[model samples]
Target: MGSQSSSFSLRIWRAARDMVVAWGRIGYLGAVVGVLLLSPSTYRGHALRPILRRMYRDTAPILLGFTLLAALICLVITRIVVVTALSYGLSRYALEMVIRVLVLELIPLTAALFVAMRCTIPNATELALMRQSGEWAAREQRGEALIRAEVLPRVVAGLYASVTLAALSCVVALVTAYLGVYGFTWAGLPGYTRMFGQVFNPSVTLLFVLKTWLFGLAVAIIPVSTGLYARPTHHDIRPGGELSGLARMFAVLLLIELTSLMGNYY
Candidate 1:
C-alpha cells in the first residue's frame, strides 16, 4: 500500500514538473514574439502574419473542419439548454446563462477535447515510433535541426491551430447566443456587446489567451515527451506510459481551466 502511494506521488510530482517546464517554454515564446515582430518595421498588420499564414497553409482545412463540427455540436447543446430553460420560464436570462456556460466554458473545453482527440495521440504515437526507430538519435548525432523539425514546428503549428480554433469558436458561440436569444435583430447588439464585455473583461481575456496557449502546448508537448520516454522497442512500449502522459495532459488542462475560472470569478 505504501509503495503504491509513493509511486502515485512520484507520478504527480513528475507531471507537475513537466507542466512547469512547458509554461517556462511558453513564456519564452512570448518573449520571442517581440523580436519576431520588430524586424518588419511595420505594425499595420501583425508581424506574426507570416507565421499565422504558414499555420493556415498547413492546417486551415483541419481547423475549419474542427470549427464547423464544434459549432454544430454546441449549437445543438445550446438549443437544448436554452429551450429547457425557457420551458422553466427562464427565457429572459437564458441568453446570459448560455453565453456564460456554453461560450465561456463548454466551447473551450470542447475545443481542447477535439484537439486531444485529433492531435495529441497521433503526435505522441509518431514521436514514440520515431524514438523507437532511432530517428531522434540519428538527427541528434547528425547535428540536424531536431528541435526545429521535430519539436518547434509541431509546437508552433499546434498552438496556432488551438488558438485560432478557440478564438473562432468563441466568436461563433457568441454569435449563436445572439441569434438564439434575439433572432435577427440589430437592437440586440447593445445587450450582446454589454454581456460580452462583462464576460470578456481584460482579465478574462488574458486568461482565455493563456489557457488556449497552454492547451496548445499540452496537446503538443506531453505526447512527444511521453513518446520519447517509451522503451527502445516501440511496439514493446508499456501501455501505461502513454496512458500516464495522456492522464497528465488532461489533468493540466483541467487545472488550467479551474485556475482561470477562479481567477475571473473569485
Candidate 2:
C-alpha cells in the first residue's frame, strides 16, 4: 500500500512537471514568433511566398462555407432573441441584447473554434508527423530555419483565418439582428446604428478587437507549439500528444474568453 501511494505521488509530480514544461514551451515559442513577426527582414524574398500561400490556403477555401454558416446561425439567434424580447415586452432592448450576446461574444468564439478545427489542428498534426519522421531534421541539415520557413507562416495563417472569420460573422450577426428587429425596411437603420454605437463605445470596441486578436493568437500558437515540441520517441507517450494539445488549446481559449467577459462586464 505504501509503495502504491508513493508511486501515485510520483505520477502526480511528473504530470505537474510536464504541464509546466509544456506551458513554458508554448510561451517561449509565442514570444519568438512575435519577435519574428515584428522584424521586417522576416518577410523578405522566399519567406513572403509561404506566408501568402498559407494565408490563402487557410482562408479562401473555407470563406464561403463559414460565412453561410455564420449567417444562418445569426439569423436563427436573432429571431429567437427578438421573439423572446417581444414576448416579455422588452422589445426595446432586444437589439442591444443581440448585439452584446451574438456579436460581442458568441461570433468571435465560434470563429476561433471553427478555424482551430479546420486549420490549426490539422496543421499541428502535420507538424508533429514531420517532427516524428525527421523531416524537420532534414530541413535543418540544409540550413533552413524551420521556425521561419514553416511555423511562422502557419501561425500567421491561423491568426488571419480566425480574425477574418470572426469579423465576417460579426457583420452577418449585425445585419441579421437589424433585419430581425425591424423587418425588411431601411427605416430602422438610424436607430440600429445608434444602438450599435451605444453598445460598442470606444472602450468596448477596443476590448472586442483585443479579445478577438487574443483568441486568434491562442488558436495560432498553442497547437503548433505543442506539435513542434512533441516527444514521439516514447511509445507509451506518443499516442495522445495531439489530444493533449487540443485540450490545452481549448483551456487557453476558455481562459481568454473569461478574461474578456470580466473586462467587458466586471
Candidate 3:
C-alpha cells in the first residue's frame, strides 16, 4: 500500500510537470507565431509564405465575423450610454467614458469570450477526438504534433484575432466617440488626437498589448492543452478525466486575467 501511494504521488508530480512543459512549449510556439505574423514572407522567401497564406485564409473570415459582431455590440452599447448621458445633460463626459469602458475594457474582454465561445471549444473537442482515435500520434510520429499543428494554430490565431479586434475596435470606438461627442469637423480631430494621446499613455498601450496577448494565449491554449493532460499514455480515459480539463481551463484563464489586471493597474 505504501509503495502504491508513493507511485500515485509520483504520477501526480509527473502530470504536473508535463503540464508545465506543455505551457512552456506553447510559449515558444507563441514566439514563433509572433515572428511569422510580424515579419514578411519576403524575408524568409517561400518557407514562411505557405504558413502566412494558410494563416490569412483561416484568419480573414474569423476576423471579419468578430469585427462585425464587436462593432455592432460596441455601437449599440455606445449609443445607449451616449443617449442616456445626453438625456441627462452630461454629453460632454460621455465620449470619454464610453471610450474607456467600451474600448479599453469591454471590447477586448468580449472579443476573448467571443473567440473562446466560437473557437476554443471546437479546438478542444477535435483534439480530444483525435486523441481518442490515436490518429494524432500516427500523424507526426510525435504525439505533440497534435499540439503543434491543431492546437497551436488556433492558439496563435486566437491571439491574432483578439489583438487585431481590440486594436481595430479601439479605432472604431474612438471614431464613433469622436462623432458622437464633437461634431464632424476639422476642429474636433486635433482635440480628439490630443485626448486620445492623453488617455492612451505608453504604459497603458504596453499593458493593453501584453494583456491581450496573454489573454489570447490563455483562452485558446488552456482548453486544448488541459484536454491533452487528461489522456494517459494509454488510450482509455482516467478518473476525473473529462471535467478536469474544462475546469482547469476556466480557472487558469481567470487567474491569468486577474493577475494581468492587477499587475497593470497596481
Candidate 4:
C-alpha cells in the first residue's frame, strides 16, 4: 500500500511538472511571436511566402466546409430564437437574441475549435515526428532560427485561418439571422439595424473583438508549443506525442472561452 501510494504521488507530481513546463514553452512561443512581429526581416525572402501559399491550399477547403456548417447552424438557431421570442411575446427582441447568442458568442468559439482540431493537431503531430527523427537537433546545433524561419509561418497561418473562419461564419450568421427574422425583404432593414446597434454596444463590441483575437491566438499557439515541448525519446513518443498536446490545447481553449463568457455576461 505504501509503495502504491508513493507511485501514485510520483505520477501526479510528474504530470503537474509537465504541465508547468508546457506552459512555460507556450510563453516562450508568445515571446517569439512578438519578436517576429517587430522584425521586418522575418517576413522577407521566400521562407514565409511559400508557407502562405501552402497554408492557403491546406486550410481553404476546410474553412469553406465549416462556413457552410456555420450557416446551417445559424439558420437553425435563428429559427429557434425567433420562434421562442414570438411564443413568449418578445418578438421584437428576436434579432437581439440572435446577435447576442449566435454572433457574439457561439460562432467564434466553434471556429477556433474547428481550426484547432482540423489544422493544429496535424501540424503538431508532424512537428513531433520531426523532433523524434532528430530533424531539429542539427538545426539547433547550427544556430538556425527555428521560430522565425520555420515555426513562425505555421503559427501565423493558423491565426489567419482562425480569423478568416470566424469572420466568415459571423457574417453568414448575421445574414441568416436577418433572413430568418425578416425574410427576403428590405422592409425590416431599419428595425434590424436598430436592433443590431442595440445589441452590439461599445463594451460588448470591444469584448467580442478581444475574445475573437484571443481565440485565434490560443488556437495558433497551444498545439505548436505542445509539439515543440514533447519528448523525443522512443519510450515516450507513442503515448505522449499527440495526446498530451491535444489535452493541453483543449484545456487552454476552454479557459479562454470561459473567461470570455464571464466577461461578456457577468
Q: Write the per-residue lDDT of candidate 2 for residues 1-266, one digit (tens) a residue.
A: 99999999999999999999999999999999999999998889877899999999999999999999988988898899889999999999888998999999999999999998898877887888888888889999999888988999999999999999999889988888888778899999999898888999998999999999999998999988887888886553332246778889889889988988998998
Each candidate: RMSD = 5.5, 1.8, 5.4, 2.2
lDDT of 4: 0.82
Count of backbone collisions in candidate 2: 0
Most accurate candidate by lDDT: 2
Task: Quote the lDDT for 105 in model 2.
Answer: 95
What is the Cα-based lDDT of residue 63 in candidate 2? 92
- Cα-based TM-score, every candidate: 0.75, 0.95, 0.70, 0.91
lDDT string, candidate 3, 1-266, tens digits: 99999999999999899767866754665566556457564246444444455356545767777777766776777788889999999987777678778776777777776766666655566666666677767876853434435654665665666667677876776776676566577777876677778767888777777767776776666665555444544544432235555565567667766775676568
Higher-ranked by TM-score: 1 or 2: 2
Better of 1 and 3 by lDDT: 1
lDDT of 1 by residue, 1-266 (tens): 99999999999999889767755654564454434335454233543444455456546767778778877866777788789988999876777788778767777767766765666556556666776677878888989745444544454656666777788898887777677667888998987788778777888788877877777776656655565455675356533246666777788789988987898778
Q: Please count the clashing residue pairs in each candidate, in the order shown.
A: 0, 0, 0, 0
Question: On TM-score, who's better, 1 or 4?
Answer: 4
Worst ten-residue run, lDDT, model 4?
Answer: 232-241
Model 3 regions lying over 4 Å from their true place: 1-50, 87-89, 140-147, 232-246, 259-266
Residues 120-201 of candidate 4 have per-residue lDDT tens digits of: 6667666777778888888888998777766777788788888889999999999999999889999999988888888788
Q: How far is 82's C-alpha from truth in model 1 (Å)?
A: 2.2
lDDT of 3: 0.65
Compared with the true structure, all predictions reach lDDT values of 0.68, 0.89, 0.65, 0.82
